[model samples]
Target: MGINKERSAWEKVNMARAQERPSAKQYIDRIFDNFMEFHGDRNFGDDPAIIGGIAQLDGRSVTVIAQQKGENTKDNIFRNFGCPHPEGYRKALRLMLQAEKFGRPVICFVDTQGAYCGIGAEERGQGEAIARNLVTMMNLKTPIISVVIGQGGSGGALALAVADEVWMLENSVYSILSPEGFASILWKDASRAQEAADIMKLTAEDLLSLKVIDRVIMEPNGGAHKNIDAMATILKDRFISTLEKLCSLEEDKLLMKRYEKFRKIGYYKE
Candidate 1:
C-alpha cells in the first residue's frame, strides 16, 4: 500500500532483487491448477529460464508462460539467473501460437534482468527471436495479459509483454535497461545506479503514472515473498476478472484494442 508509495525507485529495485521475492514458478504453482509443463524449442536445446505450459485458470483453459528465477545461488546457476536465451523465447512463442489456435487466453509473468547477452545466445538469434515474438504477439488473437512480477528489462521482457493489458507488482521494475547498465553507459559509473534507477522511472508506481502499466498489484507490508499466498490471491483475482472481459470481446475487436493499447504508448513529448 503506502509502503510501495513511500519507497524510492532504488528501494523498489532492491526489493525486486530480494531473494525472498516470490518467483514466477511460485506464483504459477499457487494461482493455476493442472499445470502441464512442456519442454524444448524444437530448434535448439530446452531452456530452464523460460517455463511454459497449458494450465487451468479457475476452470478455464489458459496458457501460462513465465521467466523463472531461482531463490538461491545453485538454482540461479541452473536457471541462468532468469536470463532467457533465444530458444527460451522460441519455446514460449510455440506455446503462445498453440494457445491462439486453441482459443485459450495467454498469461505471461515477466521477471528478468534482461535476456541472456552471451555470445552463444547472440549466435542463436536472440534478437530475431525477441523481435519475432513482439510482432506475433502484437497480432495474436487470444486475450493476453502480462504481469511484471519483478524485473522487466529491455526487449527480453517486452517480447512477452505485448498484451491487451500489462500489469506490475508494487515493487517490480520495468525498464529499457538495468539501472547499473544505464549508469555505466550514460554516466560512465555503475556506482550511480541509485540515481540511474530514479532517472529511468522503472518502478511500478512510475510506470503506472506514465501509463506504461495498467495496474499495480499491491504487495503486503513486508513484500510479496513475505506473503506469497496473499500476492497470489490478488493476482488470481485480477487474472480472472481481466480475462473474463477480454475473452468476451469479438476477435477483431480484441486485436484492435490490443493494437491501440500499444500504439498509444510513448505519445508524450518532452
Candidate 2:
C-alpha cells in the first residue's frame, strides 16, 4: 500500500483531516449506487487511469469522474498509478461534454500525481489534450464541482479542477508540481522533497486561506479511511448543498462566477 511516512509533525496532527487509504475506489463504490461506468476515448483505447460513469447519490443522478490508482503492483500497472495519458483526458472531456449537454451536474474526484509524461503520451498529444480539457472545462455550461480527494498534481489535476466550485479534503494536497519534481528542479536534490512540500503550501488549509479552494471538506478524526461511511455522508451532504446553490444561479452568472473565482486566485498586493 502507498504510505505517507515522511510528512512533518504538523501534517501528522492534521492527518485526521482525511484518512490514508489503500485505494479510493472502495469508498466510491460503497457510497454511490447504480453506477454505470463508461469506457474508451473512442479514438483510442480506454485509459484505466480515468474512470467515469453515471451514478445516484441520495437517489439523485449525477455524473462522476475519478482518477483511480491501484493497491498492488498488478493494479498499479493496470491503473498507471492514476497517471493518465492523452486519451484519458480526452475521455474525461467527452464525459464532461455529455454532462453539459444533458444538463446534469458533474462531480469529479481528483487523485493523481500528474499526467503521464512518457514519450508515448507526448507523441499522442498529451499537452494538447490537457490544454483542450482546461478550455472546455472553463466554458462548460453545466454545474460542475471538483473534489481533490488525494494527490492533485500538475496538469492532471488542473484538467478536472476548472469547475464551478473546487473542494479539497483536508488532508489532500494540490500543487502545480510534485514536491520531488520541484525539489529536483530547484535544489538539484530529490531528497529535499519534504522542504519543497512545506514551501509549496499545497495543503487544503493553505489553499483555502489563499482562496484557491472553495472549502476544506472535513475528514474523520483519524482520516477518511478510518471512517469511510462518515466521510462519504459528509461529502454527499456538502455536494448536495453546493450543487443546489450553483443550480439556483443563471447560466451566465454561474459562468461569470467561475471565471471570477479563478481570475482572483493569485491576487495580492505588496
Candidate number with greatest lDDT: 1
- Residue 231 in candidate 2 has what lDDT? 83
Encode model 1's per-residue lDDT on 229-256: one tens digit a residue. Answer: 9999999999999999889989988887
Write down the worst ten-residue block by lDDT for model 2: 13-22
Error of 2 at 128 (Å): 0.6
| Model 2, runs deviating above 4 Å | 1-22, 265-270
* TM-score on alpha carbons, each prediction: 0.96, 0.90
RMSD of each: 2.9, 4.7
Please give the CA lDDT of all the candidate structures. Answer: 0.92, 0.81
